[model samples]
Target: MAICNQSQFKPISISPKTNHLSNFNLQISRSQTLLKCHNNNTSSLPTKTLKIEPLPLFTSVRSFAPATVANLGPGFDFLGCAVDGIGDYVTLNVDPEVQPGQISISDINGVGNSGKLSKNPLWNCAGIAAISVMRMLGVQSVGLSISLEKGLPLGSGLGSSAASAAAAAVAVNEMFGGVLSESELVLAGLESEAKVSGYHADNVAPAIMGGFVLIRSYDPLDIIQLRFPMEKELFFVLVNPDFEAPTKKMRAVLPSEIAMSDHIWNSSQAGSLVAAVLQGDLRGLGKALSSDRIVEPKRAPLIPGMGAVKNAAIGAGAFGCTISGAGPTAVAVTDNEQKGRDIGEKMVEAFWREGNLKATATVRSLDRVGARLISSNS
Candidate 1:
């Protein structure tokens, strides 16, 4: 509805010197010797019997950062994107005595639930994923300490939790000489997610592989990476109302059954939205984005002034407005950061008027690069 037009795009760069998250250290590598299966193996050792070796200590420190956005419109539990605008960091160091099954986290920084941080590896999704990946690779005994730096806000619909889980899994894999494939790492990441958000691969997959992903199936997990094709400039504004709406609560509110017409409409919109993104058709994408017939309407009422905020963003030149993940936070797309800021201001104003609640809005861009190895100097 609301569209903002401006000329300048903000300069985006990655900075390494400044530490936004708490510093951490650790390493994951394979065991050096193979276990003998039988005396016959001395003459013809089976390939499976090959000894797993521990990777040499990292030549330099390394960091893995992942960008993520949950509930990408109609594909609740089935779609997500690695947003370049925000992410989390994992720093690890090698400890020969640390053993693979053991993982310790220190230097927990950023805004996170302190109680959640204090838990052991078995309870922490991120820690579990990291440790699991290492063990599966035959690094049975890894000794390392991890420092998790959370950049995204907790429970803000920004996928902060997923990013942390993804980054840890990825960083540990890379630290261990890349023992796992991209998809394998995603599977490991989802193991952590299952502990909290149930068995969902949409968010974790994208965070690992990067780009726009379509979760075609869940059980045997099928994922498709969609290319972003846009001729016109595109940007995003993230506005979190500083509230928490658990994904579980939102999913519970959704109807397990939907009208035939609603299903057809939502399917069409999802298909069209994917096509529009690939075609670089901003207007079509916007229309499709706002065309969710199943989830938004039912859950919006729970988010205070969602309607007013959406209306205000549209009025202020946002291509379209939608709940960021579940509820509370809203996302607006525009051509430039300047317009995004303006739209964010208007959206916040609208929320104040309708729900009498204050909200925070930030201008951002689609993160095309996804999760990346920023530097090895952990």
Candidate 2:
């Protein structure tokens, strides 16, 4: 159930100077859509002509958006996938007490420094997204109160902010009867993500749509949903060390220009990673995931235990391992939870022994369901 929109939020502009992704771009428009899907799942955006549906309107609604791993190796700022079992929750309540059409943050509490998050709609990710939805709906007199529950650790490269923004966007849309399309929801989330994180949809797109999303373009906002092989069951080993690598800082370390050789090499690897996922070649996937010649090398050194943890995961038979999203959190993919846990143990031990950093490890499967309504009431 989704619809697309062209309503762009102000003060949050997307840069148009970026290159395009290697995948085919699909557009979801406000009136109609070129994006295709089989049924309800937005993740099924491969090839079937489908209609969009919005959630039922409610006076109060709670929504959830899963955490995501952006970049997915060489597909930096373009590819990402949602992780199951961990995310952020947001609840929206119609408030006649507040000014009509304005948004207010009534509460915020979760993992990381939730207490430190701003309450202003202009500053908060959830608030910003909610407001974006309000604009999309053209409601200048309907007041809404937002409550956020942070499940993902902030600055841990787990799409924490994106989850909050996605949840809040969907919550607001649900309140007004799901008129906004899926692309509109993503656009709303992107408004918040670009303000806080860099101007990229790699994190927010997958957080809103679920599963894997490949960003084909930015200017017109073209997206393509990429799904792994249905027969292959992939497990993610996420180890979040008690370290903060802000998105701003991590992005700062990236080089402005890379050699042509490096570009070719990384391009090939990115292609292989996508192919491996499609063909169920775990070994290929791992090699491609770990073979980032440019971004990972520079970023890895910044995260104290990253190099050792990556080595540890590979040593423990992980299919592929690399820094998740930004950094400080290392993510590895494998075929089984048992193997994933074993890899996680080695990575954790490596962080302690080498980097002298404490880390927590969790294993989860790929989230087929991205952002969804958790509960609602009149």
Candidate 3:
């Protein structure tokens, strides 16, 4: 999810520059019905659960959560998968001398934040998640110190904040004796994510649980976990351009409604993508991923060089390509790492030659192990 940077917001005022008619209409509609439409139907969906390893009970612990790619074309706000080799890390230490159930931030520095990230627990994603865990567990007198190490770039559409939230949730949970289940920890992480990103689970769920996760419903948090067959080999080529797409602005551009025909088309593609994941059908997955007629069409134009980079990827033998998370970071899938690297090169070149943007690409597989403890002092 593309988190709206807090600093990016300013006092609302009429601008001398006029919005295009289409945009003006969309924003008007969003403002009108955004609140009243969310009537919570009490009808409940069956809940799903996830289980994770308990770290050794210790006074201090460090946890790592992998980066994630959300949306997956048609599965907006639901489908996501943890990426290997890139993510955020959190370190927690028991501070008995401080007030009970209070979490203090010792440091938050990494990636490209340059000290811009908030140190306040309430404002920071990691801090918020950790504090939520404390409240959930009825923590009375345990003070924890947190240190964040960001390995993922901020707002790259790679679930940077979600990674931080997941790592913090895991770190805090383990530090407090591992009382929370995987599902509960995900819920804790979601609490923080909802404060920054829109209320969605696509990023936080996968970052906490790992694997490919389908959020069946947000009401009861029904997460249907799926995986590729062991025999099937797939890799994700993530190309992040030098750009930031704020979540608020990205969402503001979307239409509130779609034609029934378009709805059915996206539904079919979403189901096909799920089936592809189940059967290890990389080709099918790619087709479904690239065939989204809804969000991608609207979002592609917003990202510079997206169309040409996608074409370059497919022509270079990528199974399929689409925008990852929100924008600026386009993702492609393939069966071969070498092929993925080549695709990355093509996409990177397109970003420079076509979009005039410099970008970096990394090839990685899915991370089956989500957030986990690295070290702890028993």
Indicate which candidate wins on TM-score.
2
Task: Give the runs in model 3 whose Cα sits over 4 Å from its true position.
Answer: 1-56
Cα RMSDs, all models: 11.3, 8.6, 14.4
Which candidate number maximizes lDDT?
2
Give the CA lDDT, 0 to 100, for residue 57 in model 3. 50
Model 1 whole-model lDDT (C-alpha atoms): 0.68
Q: What is the lDDT, from 0 to 100, of the residue 236 in candidate 2?
A: 92
- Tens-digit per-residue lDDT, 73-125, candidate 1: 66666777776757888777666556655777766677645344644776666
- In order of appearance, the predictions have TM-scores of 0.83, 0.86, 0.84
Candidate 3 residue pairs in backbone clash = 100-141, 101-142
Instruction: Give the clash total for candidate 3.
Output: 2
Model 2 clash pairs are: 2-181, 2-182, 3-181, 3-182, 101-141, 101-142
User: Tens-digit lDDT track for model 2 on 319-341?
Assistant: 88999988789999999999899
Task: Please identify which of the two predictions, 1 or 3, would achieve the higher lDDT against the true structure.
Answer: 3
